[model samples]
Target: MTRELTPKGSATRQRIIEGAAAEIREHGVAATTLDDVRTRTGTSKSQLFHYFPGGREELLLAVARYEAGRVLSDQQPQLSRLTSWRAWEEWRDVLIQRYRRQAWDCPLDAVVSQLGRSTPGAQAVLTELLNRWQGEIAAGVRAMQEQGEIDPGLDAGQAAAALLAGIQGGVVIMLSTGRLTHLEAALDVAIQHLRESRDRHPADH
Candidate 1:
């Protein structure tokens, strides 16, 4: 069983994780060492071990979680308030701008790759991130439905899932090709589809 950390201990642990993420971001995950993290965070070896007893892999997982949180947090208030067409457009623009700024460097992907995508820890982090993201999108869909802006009979969960898949695909392509066209198209098409559903089911609204 894991021991619970005190407030200060939690802060120290978070500092170490943030430092490690920065190190990975600067030097790439393969080149970052525990010592690099320690030096960056001003943490002693024993202190590092106290918080991450599993050593490097454990610290990497913590960083992975941090990066995962950043993925959603970066989207900000727009992501949470997708109740209207304008809000959705703003959210879409924010997401695109985030990736455009990131370009090819994806810190979360790097850490996950280093940790082995098949590993339980990495898989759990990814699954949780995707589930949370999809849930938010589904909530947005339901909100539109309530406002009579979307078809009442449409499956919000399924629609969200498809849209999320498209976004993921576009991200992968952007990472490979350094182009935002696919991602933009995916967001635009998905939102357009949602709007068109209103036209198709006007009577239901």
Candidate 2:
């Protein structure tokens, strides 16, 4: 069931989640506790329970959603302003730099993995974030197509999906190897393919 909150209640809930995130970032999800969140956020136990009626799991899910939002936020306005080739290149560098700075430490993933992606709230947050992100990318590709910057024949949906898949795969590899090779290779191949595909259209030159 969805929990409804008043304006003040909503603010308090957000405070707890933000505090929880900070605690998790410092000591990880396994080590963060309800008391820590309460103390950190300056919220009382009753106040905490008022917002998180379902308790720790529910709070973690909310934080999961918040962190998922960050994943996309970190990529903007570069992602949002991809109307030209230069914008795409700039966005690519931003993407690479963001992940490079976050190596070996996916705190959000740590929490979600513990919560189980199969959980309804967790799954919904991820699905929405990914779909929205991919849609933005697809829109950018379409905009470039309309500007005659890329091949009009290019499938925007497929290209965007491929890009998102590559990003996810790259992140997984980075998590496993503590390096950016996978991400760099994925972006390099995808971008190279895009450039080559554009070249294939005679009028694209």
Candidate 3:
């Protein structure tokens, strides 16, 4: 069984994890070591081990989870309140800016790459993130359908899946080419398609 930590102990443990995440971000995961984390967090070997009994791999899993959460958190109120066309546009801008600020080097991608996709916990982290992301997009599509801003006959789930795939593919290209144009284009085109669908089926609205 896992040991329960006092409030102070919990804070310390969180500090260690945050510190380790920063270290990995700066040095890359393959280059970061437990000693580096200990020194950076001002924690001793025992404290580090106490929190991460499974050692580096366990700590890495924790970091992966953290980064995954960060990805969705960064999208914020815009992602959650995508009820109107204006809101969707705002969300699009937010997504573009968020990734642009990363300069094509996504933090979550770094963690997944270092941990390797085949790692036991890594895929779960990715799958959860993608599912939540696609869910939000799907929700936004359904909202527009209900509002009569999109075609009622459209498949919200499939539209969301295609949009999500386009986004990921565009991000991959951005990473490879160091250009945000594809990402921007993908979002604009996807949103435009939904808008055009409404136009195509005016009687359905």
Candidate 4:
């Protein structure tokens, strides 16, 4: 069973996680080690084990959760408010800019790659992140539908799924090729489809 931590213990654990995450971000997972985290966090072997008794895998899982949270947090209030065409455009720009800046390294991707998707902890973290992101996108689509800004008959869930898939593909390509063309195109085309629906349903507006 996990032991409940005092406030000081909680802070210490968080410090280790943050320091480990930073080490992973800079050195890649294979290059990072417990010793590295220990040095970076100014913690001893006993202290590290105190919080993460399961050892490296457990600590890695913790870092994976942290990085996944960062992915959504980075998108911020923009992602939360995709209610209008203007708002969607702003969200899209934020997505593009955020990924572009992160082109040097994507911490979540690195951690997931290290842990392997089949790992239960990694899969759970990814599933939660994607589901939450898709849910927000669906909510935005529904808002647009309610506003009569798009086809009322359109499936918000399906549209959001496709858009999200396109985005993931575009990011993968961008990461591989060091170019943002695919990402921009995917977002542009997805948004264009919504705008076209709006045009077709102008009478509904």
| Top candidate, metric TM-score | 1
Indicate the worst ten consecutive residues by lDDT in candidate 4. 196-205
lDDT of 2 by residue, 1-205 (tens): 5667789877877889999999998999889899999989999999898888889998898888899989999999989987987888888899999999999988778888979979887789889989999998999888887777678899999999999999999998999998898888888787777667667773433
Q: Residue by residue across 1-205, what tens digits does model 1's lDDT show?
A: 2789999999999999999999999999999999999999999999999999999999999999999999999988988899999999999999999999999989999999999999999999999999999999999999999999999889999999999999999999999999999999999999999999988897452
TM-score between model 4 and native: 0.94
Per-model CA lDDT versus the true structure:
0.95, 0.87, 0.89, 0.91
Q: After superposition, how far is residue 170 of candidate 2 from its true place, in Å?
A: 0.6
Error of 4 at 116 (Å): 1.5
Query: Using lDDT as the measure, what is the rank order of every candidate, best first?
Result: 1, 4, 3, 2
Give the 10-residue window scoring lowest on summed lDDT in candidate 1: 196-205
| Model 3: residues with Cα > 4 Å off, grouped in runs | 1-6, 203-205
**Positional deviation of 108 in candidate 2, in angstroms?**
2.0
lDDT of 1: 0.95
Model 4's alpha-carbon lDDT is 0.91
Clashing pairs in 3: none
* Better model by lDDT: candidate 2 vs candidate 4: 4
Give candidate 4's root-mean-square deviation (CA, Å): 1.5
Off by over 4 Å in 4: 1-3, 203-205
Tell me the TM-score of each prediction against the true structure. Answer: 0.98, 0.94, 0.93, 0.94
